[model samples]
Target: MTALFDVILPVFLVVGFGYLVCWRKWLTEVAVDGVMRFAQNFALPVLLFSAIARLDLGANYNPLLLLAFYCGAILSFLLGVALARYWLKRPIEDAIAIGFVCLFSNSLLLGVPITERAYGAEALVGNFTIISIHSPLLYTFGITAMEFARAQGQNLPLGRVALRALSGVLHTPLVIGILCGFAMNLMGLAGLVMPDGFWAAVTMMSSAALPAALFGLGGILYRYRPEGEMRAIALCCFGSLLLHPAVTFGLGKLFALSIAEMRSAVVTAAMPPGVNAYLFAALYGVAKRVSASAVLVATGLSILTVWFWLGALP
Candidate 1:
């Protein structure tokens, strides 16, 4: 109850507020899109850049932790694809979009803040470690898979398909921001090159990333009805809320990860599908309904699911 009220409810309150405002017609769809655009293209990217720039890669980049967490993520993706393709009778492209939804957890907006609230700021190093490469790695994998799925049966050369996919991934603002952060970190130019004022301004913008995105997500979600994808949405919710974290928890135990690492990995894995899931679906024009409904339903379900996981965790 404490976790439900203290940790999860506060987050949903913001989402609910957005939904209420949109329901009352106070915020138009275009306005919501503008907010999302600001968050996705600018503020969130700045947040990622700042987080990765100052990330202590040497101390927190635990290979075992990453291995445990990502193994679960990949398994969920594969399961989502398989179940959607075989059981749900969705097309290959739709299956891939569903898989992407299951694969891409809300690591940033939900995971980081939830972990911070549940544990503490001091415990966020593991969350940060996972997040540092979360977008880049998952986006790459999802895009590559999607491209390959789209390329099936076409005479398009494999190299061209690969290049096209690569181009799409590279052109994303989030990916660009992550790459820039990595370059800065690797080249040791974080503090040395950028002026303090620049960093401060980044700090200011980055702070709005989560709240604004969450609010925008609520409004955007209002546009997507669950409709005919009940089974698919249930599968997505199951994979994201239960299967992913179960795999992560088992792997973490096998790896003997510390309490903090286990907490971070499982909690992150338990988050609902992010807005990117719907964005990916919308971008590819496949399974948009399922993706969006899953985002909405899973996010609502996560209010309870995350509370359970928090109790189940050490």
Candidate 2:
């Protein structure tokens, strides 16, 4: 279908290219690590700041739509936790990881680019707003879940853990970028002009971020496979591909969104599991197996899911 060609095919191309590079040893773990570090540290921050700084905070933004999106994410996360705990009977740590995989989508790298392609630049403001809120949830609640799992046999300083988690959220580059953008917007000082040369340089660097992040993701996926964790991975893929998007579509109607806003919300909900889920899992010593599996399954499944959603869009 035309939708498959336009929206889904491009994602596969990027991911497939990375897979080939990794398979051929063109990108090693070291190279992937370096690229990821660069993305997290520099390129992503620049992209976020630039996008948010230019956005008009006073514009006709729909707060209710944003609220609905967050509610959907929270419910999805809870559902994932319940399924993992009761149905799968997974260990506490693994359940937490599974819940995160089901809920925490790659909204920054994959979501932004895909939504822009589907809905255009105006939708980015809403998309970024969602990311800003969602990032903290992924970092804090996700980490706490893992900690709870890890501390099952031992004791943990719950108060200290909460404070540390909050600190981590405050210090994250993405959070910092969002804060700076908000401050700039609030002060109405983002209108300060930059030289053409400066603008060109930032544009060049910002452009490289998306492709590099995608390629890094592809390489990571190439290096890892779900292997024996197929069942857990399948559940996550289904949640991301089917359940989350369906809920988002239903909620969008309740919000009385315009066609474009509804499309943006649906596409965002359909995004694959986020790279951050893996990072948090690894950091917290939780279900590393499921985390790795999630990356592989989510990336592969997104091709079909995105195609279907785009096709059904009016």
Candidate 3:
């Protein structure tokens, strides 16, 4: 109960607040869109870089932990695709979108802070490891799948595809921020004594990122209405809100993660679909409605699902 109120409640309250503002027309769609970009392009990257750079990961980092979490996530993504295409009979593009919503979690906006509350601040190192790679990996896999599904052909030019994917990733602020953090860590600059202003600015950005993201997420959700294959949306929400976490739990145990790591893993896996899932679907010119609906549905349902996982965690 404390876990629920301490972490989960605050996140949702901000989301609800965003919904209220939009409903009241106190903030226009244009205003919310600007906030969205700010949260995405600036605040989140700063927050991620600051967290990753400060932590002394040393012996705390675990390769097997990443392997387990990603394996489960990829498996869940594939399962969503299969269900959408085979059972729901959605088109290839929609199927790819379904896979993405299932794979991508709202780890940044709702994840990092909540996990810190659930486990402890040290849990952030584990959280950063997941956040740092989650986007780039998902982008590569989802983009490759979309391109191949659209144009099935000779050899598929995977090297070219990978390069193209790398290019997109290079431009993203989140990835750049992470790279900067890693570079700082490698150069031992993370340990250098910095001015109070430097720390204060990082703290401000990091602190602002989550709440702004949540509010911006609410605005986006309220602004978009669901218009797609209902069956596909249902399957996507199911995969995201339920099955992904289940698979992650089994994999976390199989990888022999610590109690704290498993708690972080399971809690993170249970997060709702991210807004970027819809962004990708829109970018690829398919499944936008289904993606948007899944984001909304998974978020609404996650309140119950999150509680289940937090209680289930040790």
Candidate 4:
């Protein structure tokens, strides 16, 4: 019970603050834009790098657990696509956005903070592993899904799409940060500690990233309400809130993960629709409305859903 409050409530508080600010016009879109730009371009990359750099990627790491997490994400994503297509009868582009929303979670902003509070810093390694896998999937398969939707009966430039997607992966600061961190870890260079001033600067900036991103998400939500898109948002939220977590929990149990790991996986799975879904929609020029709707609804609902799941975890 205490864990629920400790781990989950603070996230809601920050988001609520952001929402209020935006709703009251306390923070203009320009301000929100600037903050988001900073988060995406600077703070997030540092956070990713720090998390990856700190992982001890040797023998004790659990490959099976990693596989289970990846498989669960994939299955849930496909399930989302199916539901959007058959039940919602949405266009392919909208359906793809729905699917992407369900699959891609805000593991960084919400998941990492909650899990670290609940389990401890050691859990960051598993979280990082999931993000690493998710990043490539987001760039390649996820982007392709959007492109397919956007192609809209027209022939897709397969080679061009592939190249563009690969280029996106290459240019992502977060991905580059991860690669650098991994290289440092692999080369046994992580031991070379930075000077105190540099380390302090990194820590300070990384610490600010999550809250700023969450607040920016709230600002986005404020900018875009989900009133008209309720049906699609509901479906996407259900997949993210109920089905994904349920499946992940079951997989964790089947794989005999520790209680902590199971809890972590469940929380990770239950994260809200990622902000990246909207970014991808804009990039692919498909179903931007649906993507925006998913982001707003999922994020708004996740506060309660996360608290409930955390309460049930013991």
Q: lDDT for each of the candidates?
A: 0.88, 0.76, 0.82, 0.77
Clashing pairs in 1: none
* Candidate 3 deviant stretches above 4 angstroms: 154-156, 189-196
Among residues 3 or more apart in sequence or in different chains, the pairs in candidate 4 whose N, CA or C atoms overlap within 3 Å are none
Q: Candidate 4: what lDDT?
A: 0.77
Residue-level lDDT tens digits of model 4 in 1-314: 67657877777777778888889999898998898888888898888877676676774367766666666677767987888888888777767777887778887888988888877887666778777656766667787766555666678788876776687777877788778767766655546665679668879999989989878767777877565467777777887887788778777878988776676678888898787877877776766777788888788788788877777665
Question: Candidate 3: which pairs clash?
Answer: none
TM-score of each: 0.95, 0.90, 0.94, 0.90
lDDT tens digits, residues 1-314, model 3? Answer: 77678878887889999988998999999999999889888998888888777767776578877776787688879998899889888887888888998898888887776787777787777778777788878887888787777767556676777777778777888888888777766666536665789879999987888888889889888976777787887887777778888888888888888987787777878888888888888988788888998898888888878988998888
Q: What is the C-alpha RMSD of each candidate to the true structure, in Å?
A: 1.6, 2.4, 1.9, 2.4
Q: Considering every candidate listed, which one attains the maximal lDDT?
A: 1
Task: List model 1 lDDT by residue over 40-142, tens digit each.
Answer: 8998888888878777778789999999989999999999999999999999999999998899999988897789889987888888788877877888788
Error of 3 at 158 (Å): 3.1
Best by TM-score: 1
On the 0 to 100 scale, the lDDT of residue 154 in model 3 is: 54
